[model samples]
Target chain A: MLDHNAAAARIFTAALIVIGDEILSGRTHDKNIAQVATWLQVQGIRLKEVRVVADEEPAIVEAVNTLRARNDYLFTTGGIGPTHDDITVDAIAAALGVGVEVHPAARAILEDYYATRGGLTEARLRMARVPAGADLIPNRFTGAPGIRWGNIYIMAGVPSITAGMLEALTGTLEGGAPLLSETIGCWVGESEVADLLRQTEKTHEGCQIGSYPFWREGRTGANFVIRSVDPDRLAACCAALAAGLTAGGRTPVAGGL
Target chain B: MLDHNAAAARIFTAALIVIGDEILSGRTHDKNIAQVATWLQVQGIRLKEVRVVADEEPAIVEAVNTLRARNDYLFTTGGIGPTHDDITVDAIAAALGVGVEVHPAARAILEDYYATRGGLTEARLRMARVPAGADLIPNRFTGAPGIRWGNIYIMAGVPSITAGMLEALTGTLEGGAPLLSETIGCWVGESEVADLLRQTEKTHEGCQIGSYPFWREGRTGANFVIRSVDPDRLAACCAALAAGLTAGGRTPVAGGL
Candidate 1:
């Protein structure tokens, strides 16, 4: 079992398992990684790692057991629909050493939803099947609820539905202080400011600076993102970086280029 | 050691490690995952898994060692630049029990490329560092060349730069038959045709069918993606699916909606 109640000042981390073959085959561009990462940050939790796996039972089971064991929480998106490829619930159940069972509330919700559209079919009821002893995360968009078994959150592969599940999950999990960031963009090559960045990050004990270089308008530029759990330290690090860029005769853009 | 001389008819798989704090922070939506996935598909190499980790040494080292050991090929993008956060070279070296060294050829290439553009400062020279006993993957976008050691390919984080490196290394690696896919769109909910999809896929032998549901124009619809390595099997599966959709009183779109 994970020691979730370790210390108040400890960092809270979550890992995501993206279950789908479409993503691996390059048929779909995944928006859930960024969506979940951003949402976790706002909830004061850090998204430490993400694994994109194919829609296979062993693959999903391995990823679920591996990530859920290491992180504070595990969130999965995809493979929960009514199709044959939708096997996340079953895979996760096997990983947790549990049997698959239909959640009463979820079945009732699907029945009510399909009452007017069409009578509930066995295929539609597949959406209600969850790992034994699992709760439901309400979905406002579709009647199919997301599954919540232990720390594992099984969300929909669709971006909009995932967004609704995230909205419903806001402020529900315990987390540390939110990681704050300040981005400073400059129309200068990153190599020109690498030393300054290293120095600034070293000066701020709790801060980290990331340099992302890009070529735009036929000129080399980069956006340096400084992050820290402390707001005062984040601000100081950003100011130092801005000063360094100015000292090097480059005007820094506030947000990004 | 991984057996590179596997049976010719066997599937060749590769894993990708995307190392960056920007991606984990949700500040940057990753483009390299799709780019590499598409490129690897064209090369007839199936992408088995992808792990996105932060710009930390232990994280990079763990991902590198784990993925490199399991897959036929392991590729990494990001943290290969001149910034302080760029620690891919050192971390990979640590993982392989190798030492970091400045490759003379890489140094010469950087000297030539940076002669007119700022004359190769110390910070820019950092790009020349590589894991010892590693070959270079040519980069036409910038002076910094990608690294190739054993079956691991260390690529640039920038999508364009990574594309250039991938283009340079094209046709150099051996792989099996490329995976083929066909998409059929229908204006019907996936649950309505789930049984047909499951039966069709089971009957098709090697084909796997994925159903992606969407809502547009205030109407429910779905796109069924059928994939197989054998062209005949893929075509047969798509034809069967289209026929089934038509039999169920739905028009199937050939290339998806």
Candidate 2:
């Protein structure tokens, strides 16, 4: 059990960079962050950090260089389309000190997909451009395949297309045990149970407790989320928390409110 | 108009740091990024970048130090509650090379607010703690006030509470002209109009056009958003793009698809 816990501590982490002007301008609400985070969790890869940057080259390059160097994998969404504003591939190539080139597989895919809609124009061909020495992640939804350079992935800005790309890459990356979680909700203010929550977390090894308070139906309540890499540990911690809340004269909802 | 454009080019920029393990764990979807970005836009401050980091002290401290040094304002959300995981105050204090102290006004406010519900426990008093020499941003919804220290605003993690803090801060910061934008939607693939969009943007002196493509109702379409500090320039850019789209045999929707 101890060795297993120790081995599980080698967590694989990923960072996400969302590249677009619309998000920073507040014109579009970004769904990619949550989408990528949730998908990474299922793959047992912890999303360590996320950066939402503009469509500028320097910003994208800096983010790409900084995050990719530190994490196991770096994923970027947006700015891969066929517009003048789509500068992600170029910026990433610059960050890697490599030149950009049109990938043959990507070009073939786009050409065949666009044969009926419209012959691939120069603008549409931009989607085939990728960093030098890069592979392709198949985009089942969109004709333009996503770009994969070493540990970095350049995916579509559109949520549905990005989802498709992620689905294709599932189980391909090596990661540790999937982090498990259990949520317990109580109709009481968080401050009233802060001590109990802290002590419960302290008593439970390899577990973390997060308190999220809310006001709904004109009453104060909180949801305590307990997380662990071990399902048994997570369940034990959750049960302990529920027992504490019950002793404090509050009913604990097993799955949260 | 040239002088005015030059003056408007001096853009006030802000960076946001969203601190939470829940967001990173995919347990919660972040709404604060869009909320802060929209509010900053109305205040004429450009949201240059956003970093969503974990609740760990080192991550928060590093993000706070890095962003605060580069941008005009640095705002952080999350980890301000009355629990062990709520370590934002300590982290920010560490980042600023200052000590954490309970603010008198904040303590008073919490005490008064919690008087009828329950006496202010040590856990609740955690909300009163802030970086030394920081001012309070009044939270009308809850007793726990937000903190502000030298260009850094520490807001609540909850959407509604953060909204109240932003409402209190509206029109308080000095900023330049608010960026104006006009959106035109058309039932045409972005690749088909990529050249026209690029040329229209080049023709406009102080405007940028962002093309967002989507598929709806079994048809491909796009929305081109034209943004500029000068409203007239924005309007002209929108009109030129609209005319270009129309000339390409597509009807342009004024408000977007």
Candidate 3:
């Protein structure tokens, strides 16, 4: 009951569900959030929001359902390894009201991978399981494949494996133009240029300006990021914003202060 | 309407709302998530979930309301600066149905901070604004003090400032026993010993084992983390798990692989 034509013209967005108790426990510094967000940007899709949930089934299911329903695509990282704690596949199946079954192709791949080192034991075989009706997201870095079911893409918790899966998925998903941005850093307080930022963004069509303030070396500064889908408009907005900063008696740094 | 007696015995949990577009845009790598999570862990409070939202009021309001209502406490970082884009106070006020006002103590702190530098300009004075009925969480690093409205704590976006606020508020929040953990690293694939992990954890009550697999130096391995609120139980669980790994022909690394 959705209009495909209307969806095509609109911007594509994605939400990332980071599944791990280690992250919440502060034992593991998460590297997936940044990598996924950057990859989504390169694919011309906006990373709208991110939720880091625990390994619990209820938490995973709730996040998966909520994010998948709202965004054009939903990607999850972590909890897909071959161990007792790796239950992302099962959780996804439960969330989608489907049964989990071992995919033969994934089984064959794992079997071949472990044949030389060690035979695929029951524990290792867990990697072959996937939700019914899901397809394999080929992982070039590892033999255990990622999963792609509907709009949800289940990837590995490891940063390298997730990067490989993202590389395989490049240019496959339909997306709008990649968001173009320019940063204008100045040594002036952002509050002093609040009106200039507002007016510059308002004058530029389809552009948004974000002011990030920082205090470094006993001095205060801010980086103004101007973003737009169009490259030319982004440049124009950046130039105008930089000029405004100059007129306000601050020398704007090209990249950042 | 709420049962205060029932809440006193339960474990204290917190949810963090990171408010900034720079983070979602992949332009800024967030350091606040780890800092807050670690701080909460040290305080004996569990970080249950984290949601990163944009600077938009609707997103901030929704996240604040959803998290603050469900968890024992809600902490928000970013968007508490002096720029026009800093709208956390406004959004939080809207969510709590409170009015925004300049706290006299906060204003005095700002005046003292900037009196020798540039005096209290309107832009610098913006940092003193807070939601009505909220008390100040002292910040030794910066003049802009953090805000505390009931169970919600509003903090600065900068990591160092947030750290100062956290240091000042330490030992003030009521918390249960701090969670203790032990990491046992093995040179074998975690799937090969999944049953061992499950059995070990099942034998040890109040302990949960998490298997984090990794591929390094062209070899597959995993680090098994054992966690429990009781220190004695945590030690016992680690011993049993280590014995299991050793019997299975894998030398357990005491610290990590």
Give per-residue CA lDDT, model 3, range A70-95, as digits (tens). 99999999998877788899999999
Clashing pairs in 1: none
CAPRI quality level assigned to candidate 3 from its DockQ score: medium
- Candidate ranking (DockQ, best to worst): 2, 1, 3
Q: Model 1 misses residue A134 by how many Å? A: 0.5
B38-65: candidate 1 lDDT, tens digit per residue: 9999988999999999888999899999
| lDDT of candidate 3 over B132-182, digit per residue (tens) | 999999988767899999999999988889999999989999887778888
Model 2, A1-257: lDDT tens digits are 99887767889999999999999988899999999999999998999999999999999988999999999999999999998989999999999999999999999999999999889999999999999999999998778999899999999999999999999999999888888888898999999999999999999999999999999999999999999998888989998999999998999998999
**TM-scores of chain A across candidates:** 0.96, 0.97, 0.94
Q: State residue B111's C-alpha deviation in candidate 2, in Å.
A: 0.9
Residue runs of model 1 more than 4 Å from their true location after superposition: A1-8, B1-8
Q: Write the per-residue lDDT of candidate 1 for residues A1-257, one digit (tens) a residue.
A: 23543443589999999999999989899999999999999988999999999988999999999999999999999999998889999999999999999999999999999999888999999999999999999998889999999998999999999999999999999898788998899999999888999999999999999899999889999998889988888998889889889998999999988
Q: Tell me each candidate's i-RMS in Å.
A: 0.7, 0.7, 1.2
Model 2 residue B129 CA deviation in Å: 0.4
Residue A245 C-alpha lDDT in model 1: 90
Model 3 chain B: lowest-lDDT 10 consecutive positions = B1-10
List where candidate 2 sits over 4 angstroms from the true fold: A1-7, B1-9
